[model samples]
Target: MMAEKEVQLPILRSVYQDLTRSEQRIADYITSHADEIMDKTIPELARNTKSAEITISRFCKKLGFSGLQGLKIALAAELSSSGDDRFQDIHRGDSYEQVAGKIFGNIAEGMQDTLKILDYAAVERAINALVQARRVAVYGFGNSATVCRDIETRFLRFGMVVQAYDDISQQLTSASLLTAEDVVIAVSHSGSTMNLLKTVEVAKKSGAKIIVITSYAQSNLAKIGDIVLTGMGREVHYRSESVASRLIHMAITDVLYTGIAMQQPEQYQENIGKMRSVISATRE
Candidate 1:
């Protein structure tokens, strides 16, 4: 059986435009010579790229690796594969079909990679918290707020008490009202949104358990989460938020929703039926 391939290089290229000049230099050098980089030490790489060792280490972390060694290992694994031509970025001069293919391909690959790194134990813990909580509050800002709303709608179908707050002040107020019996699901792609972080801080103080859905595990928000679920994706340039990341977040939400429904099939089925009946009555 063939080993699964890592998506490091493709992820690097996807976020290349967002990297600082020094980080870009290191990324370019490593990408262009994956095999060579695997053999070189961090100091060697920094010297070769004319960048500082600390800069190289930061670059590695930015790509979701723990450090230089982790980056090299992932690079070696990826290089050993047939290579990832599917994740190539969409270019300006591409035809409609080409653009569609690239976008679809990137999303597919991202979902696959996300599955590889998913911490099922953490997911189960999060589901348990949601199942037992008296109330659930979803907090997010910007594009992440949309994800929070989507989660709210899905959970509501199961007859769960859920609230989604997009406004900063409202989120703070809602979080402050949460108690030990409540749960907070905070979504942030960057995991460093100050407003969202502030709300989470308040929620934590109120003794509400926090479940974070974010891209980086090492982020401050993730540190505060009682249970952290990561949504990994290649962020493309020119977009304010990661399209692929949103899909992963939704996928995780679907898993939690389905798992909860399965825990009590009869009651969940009844809830769905009643919800559908109410909607149908409104239409008539």
Candidate 2:
């Protein structure tokens, strides 16, 4: 449950088992001497680790760094911190109060980091795409599908045409019908979901602009996206059970929703009033 900002060591550890032998060696050397790694050039580190410079660069990208310098800068920042105690992972014997504090602290930290790294320009671009599109189709599976449904509900309130699909068959059918005037918001934390990728491919063929929300900047999903918004957070040990990612996803969705609302305030207000009146009548 470490804060996303202090991600250098945690990211390496999180994906260590998936790294190649050479990458593992590089990761080991860097983690052990993180402070010094910043001072050394990529070639120098390559020599030290007996890895080629290209290998070092590839390893950095695998961890979502732009290059060696980016990796070094992140490492330096993480190593300088004494580590936030509240963000520590939960223990077996922790009290309920301790668990609550840790969970809240971790979520807060992740949101802060996500905000810090968010590309406002890209967000604006995404908003523009959504606003200009003839239709907006949201695609996601599992927990991400819940996020997609939330987005659909928000856009629907604005009187916009939006559809969210949780089933792969329905997603493919919806995607196949999209055109260049449409926009697709594909939500996948890992960005490697094959089913989502397949749907995206079909959508792309019809010239739909893709907006991907994921944690990995260099993931396959990002590669295909017209605008890629990165969600900052490391999935804890019980990744499937973690709420941190869902929180981050909702935060990003909030930004987009507000952006669209602000762009057309008069229409948004009118739609909101109508929706409220209709819902209130149901309650009565």
Candidate 3:
């Protein structure tokens, strides 16, 4: 199936944090005057946003468009659509059903928005690296640690020599042992965790390949990564949790796990059979 096209306004909103100041100005202009943006030329848009023409072009490309024309087409389509199902807040005093609906809706939207920006080429590269590596180490911190643990659990069933590190000290120690034959999957949502970066740097010096899963592809973590997978989402009010970044990271890692399985179907089947046999014996 063909990939779904990203909606202009929602993409602009989702990736706002990663944009430069000039790009933010352009985004603000487009979002506020979306209906009128189609009528204006690129030069006119640059003038209106107090940015250069090239800046407008970069802004358009940053939003996954070819250029101004592509952005305009998406904007026009959004304008023509009947409803605005953009990000919404979960209000207080709502009934149980209302809250549940908003949470589920936001999670689904987060995944779809993430799909819009996912780099398929990078994903393939990551799978190849994992499949060939002599060892794999997954690292993350705080809320991200849960994702790391989940990856550890899933990849083990495939019989890959992988470990998850949530503690910075343990991560640094592990990094020191990685070799060029290994791969490191680092999860940092903001991509600005100093300790995580330090650990990754150590791994890089040891010559391990880096695969970064983060919200901002422009983040320092992404900069040094061999392959970068970005996840996008805006924070909702009330819970204010990053529904997008958290879930999307898990989703991408799951995709990697599945890809590795597909690459070694016979091995995967054998490993799964052995694992199931042991687990089944423990059941009543």
Candidate 4:
């Protein structure tokens, strides 16, 4: 039996299972052009196979990929020598909009990678612990600080007492002060921020709940975390915000927030009102 993490191509699930004629045709085309399809556009592939765009999309989803684009991208990676680019050419001749869209695409891919490596049972345990924690502390450095602030702001609506630490001294101080009943969510893309990890260590020995969100495996942060959520990337380009890594972190945060909300309905509603009250007052 294949593990969930090992299951990449959904299309290979069953040879005898039902498939629409159009889907079968599209799948055949993918198998034929498995080499060139990696960089092919949706319109181009559809045209080549005489298949409609929607049919191709459904075929991809039927195979377990989120869309046709994802399936092709994966297949392309398989054919390419390295399937990894240390640098991106998309920035060379692109407009700002083009750059922005490409960045978003990267983030989406990064998030998907993170999801693939994540342990759902850990997320569940973290969510339960957080919901019952006496307080929550969030810490980060650089762009990660923004992610920390964002998650903290959302967590506050549940009326959970939340704090964000940006300064090392302050974070350390707070970490030392936290009790076993408190939860700390630390954010770092590289997962190697010395200050953040130090703070996490302090929190750890103190018995505080530790959730580590980062982009590296075998990372020290991952080693200490009670829960490690990854943000993945490829070569050719270092993990840049304009591409996949940022979106991956953004997705993980959103998923955690959504889980918290769904796990505690009354608390979620109360948190919603806290945001609404500010808008209501602004209108007044």
lDDT of each: 0.81, 0.82, 0.84, 0.71
- Of the pair 3 and 4, which is ahead by lDDT? 3
Work out the TM-score per prediction: 0.78, 0.84, 0.89, 0.65
Q: Evaluate model 1: give its TM-score.
A: 0.78
Sort order, TM-score high to low: 3, 2, 1, 4
Residue-level lDDT tens digits of model 4 in 1-284: 43211222222322212456776666666665566576677788789889888877777676557986678666655445324422243646779897676666655444444555566787788788888899999999888888888888877777789989899999999999999999999888767788888999999999998987776644678778988765554322434442345456667778888888898888678768778998899998
Off by more than 4 A, model 4: 1-88, 233-244
> Where does model 1 exceed 4 Å of error?
1-33, 37-77, 80-84, 238-241
Winner by lDDT: 3
1 against 2, candidate with superior lDDT:
2
What's the CA error at residue 200 for candidate 3, in Å? 1.1
Clashing pairs for model 2 are: none
TM-score of 4: 0.65
lDDT of 3 by residue, 150-205 (tens): 99999988778999998889999999999999999999888889999999999999
Among these predicted structures, which one has the highest TM-score?
A: 3
Lowest lDDT 10-mer window, candidate 3?
Answer: 1-10
Candidate 2 error regions (>4 Å): 1-28, 57-86, 238-243
lDDT per residue, candidate 1, 57-165, as tens digits? 8988887789988987777766766355545676788898977777777777777667756679998999999999999999988778889999999999877899899
